[model samples]
Target: MQTILIIEDEKDLAELVAFNLEREGFRVMTAHDGLTGLDQASRIKPDLVILDLMLPGLLGTEVCKTMKRNEKTAAIPVLMLTAKGEEIDKVVGFEVGAEDYVVKPFSTRELILRVRALLRRAATPPSPGSVVKVGPLTLDVERHSVAIDGAEVSFTSTEFKLLHILVQRQGRLQSREVLLRDVWGYAFVEDSRTVDTHITRLRGKMGAAGELIRTVRGFGYKIEL
Candidate 1:
């Protein structure tokens, strides 16, 4: 069973979420503060983390940043739960390494669906023995690793998948909607800005090779050789 850690300060809400997730057959763990959540995540290394945006002691963003910086727990996906639904807020959450986000006053059904989706994506194994080369970037699809100019670089699963799709398609301009569907496994995304955010992050991590991922301005993005 996949273990999920819920880091929420609101005890009642956290228990409610834990109850539902446990019913879904997942092993659930809860933390009422960001610091505790961070520590628990490091110790337990759950498959996924349900992080509340606002927490006492440490903010959710800080906790996520720290987790991503740590080698032990960095690969675990994070799904941010927040009351703030602004575009910028979601952008910031993604920037901090959240794989997905759910706004406040969300329905239990939607929350469960999002959690399942994230886990599904995480469980997907990369196709073996396939490698794609774009400029100096080498993507070994089998190993789920990327290297730029022979130097290995770390990427979130979301970032890795996004890069894989773009490079696989090569030179094709993929609209945000298409990327959202293909890369994020979302049929309909509320805010396609999520694509842009991941693209930006992908580019940043690619360093000088990032220039190969060109912005198509009014459309979306494309990988140019």
Candidate 2:
């Protein structure tokens, strides 16, 4: 069974989510504060984490950043929960390495669907020993690792998947909707800005090699040599 960690300060809500997830046949763990959540994440290394944007001991963003920095836990997918639905808030959450975001007042069914989608995406098998090289970028798809000009770089699971798709379809224009569906496993596209935020971060992480990913102007993105 896949383990899911819920790092939410609201005891009632956290328990509610845990209950539903358990009913869905997942092993659930809960933490009421960000620091405890981080500790538990490092210790348990859950398959997926449901993190709240606001927490008492530490902010959820900090918890995610720390996890992304740690090699052991960096690849775990994080689904952020927040009451704020502003675009900037979502951008911040994505920037901090969250693989998905859910605004509060959301239905239990919606959350569950998202949870399942993230898990499915994370569980997708990569082609064995498949490596793609474009300019100064090299991606080992099977190992889920990236190297730029012989120097290794760390990428969150979501970022790596997004990059993998772009490189796989290199020279082909991918619309925001297509990217959201393919990379994120979202059946319906809510906001395409999520794709934008991740693309921006992907570029920054790639440094100059980021130029290999080109913007199609008012459309989406593509990879080119």
Candidate 3:
């Protein structure tokens, strides 16, 4: 069973989410604050995280940043929660490493659908069958291993799919939603932050090889080749 870690400061909301997720046959874990949430995430290494932006002790953005930086937890998908819908805040969430974003007062049905999409995307298998290399980066699709200059680079499953998509697309600009759908396979996931988080983690793992991924302003991301 897939497990989800829900990190929210509101006790009532947290319990409600946990209950719903359990009903859906998912193993659920929850935290009420950012610091505790972060610690639990590292320990459990959940399949996905439902994070609240206004968390106590540490901001959700800070927690996301730390998780994305750590090799062990970086690739875990995060769906950030927030009451504010400011464009800037959403952008910041994306920049800090959130896979998706959810506004407050959201519908429980929508929330459940989004969660299922992310989990499905995370579990989807790659189509690439052989090792594909572009410059110094080598992606062994079948084995799910990545290498830079022949040295192995550790990657989470989501990160691998994200990289494979970029490598296949090469110079074509891919919007965040497009990546989420093609790489993550979630058509209704409105939050592009999911793409940002996975991309950041992918780049960090690739080191110099990551430079192959380029940002397209007012559009999306691509591999320059």
Tell me, by lDDT, which candidate is best.
2
Poorly placed runs, candidate 2 (over 4 Å)? none
| Alpha-carbon RMSD, each predicted model | 2.5, 2.2, 4.7
Residue 148, model 1, lDDT: 96
Assess candidate 2 and give its TM-score to the true structure: 0.87
lDDT of each: 0.89, 0.91, 0.83
Highest-TM-score candidate: 2
1-225 per-residue lDDT for model 2 (tens digits): 999999999999999999999999999999999999999999999999999999999999999999988989987999999898888898788888899999998899989988988999888887567878998999998778999998999887788889999998999999999998898877556668888888988999999999999998889999998
Off by over 4 Å in 3: 129-180, 189-225
Which stretches in model 1 have alpha-carbon errors above 4 Å? 149-152, 215-219
TM per candidate: 0.85, 0.87, 0.67
For model 1, the local distance difference test gives: 0.89
Least accurate 10 contiguous residues by lDDT in model 2: 184-193
Which scores better on lDDT, 2 or 3? Answer: 2
Candidate 3 — which pairs collide?
98-193, 99-193, 99-194, 100-194
lDDT of 1 by residue, 70-112 (tens): 9999889899999988878887888878999888989898888
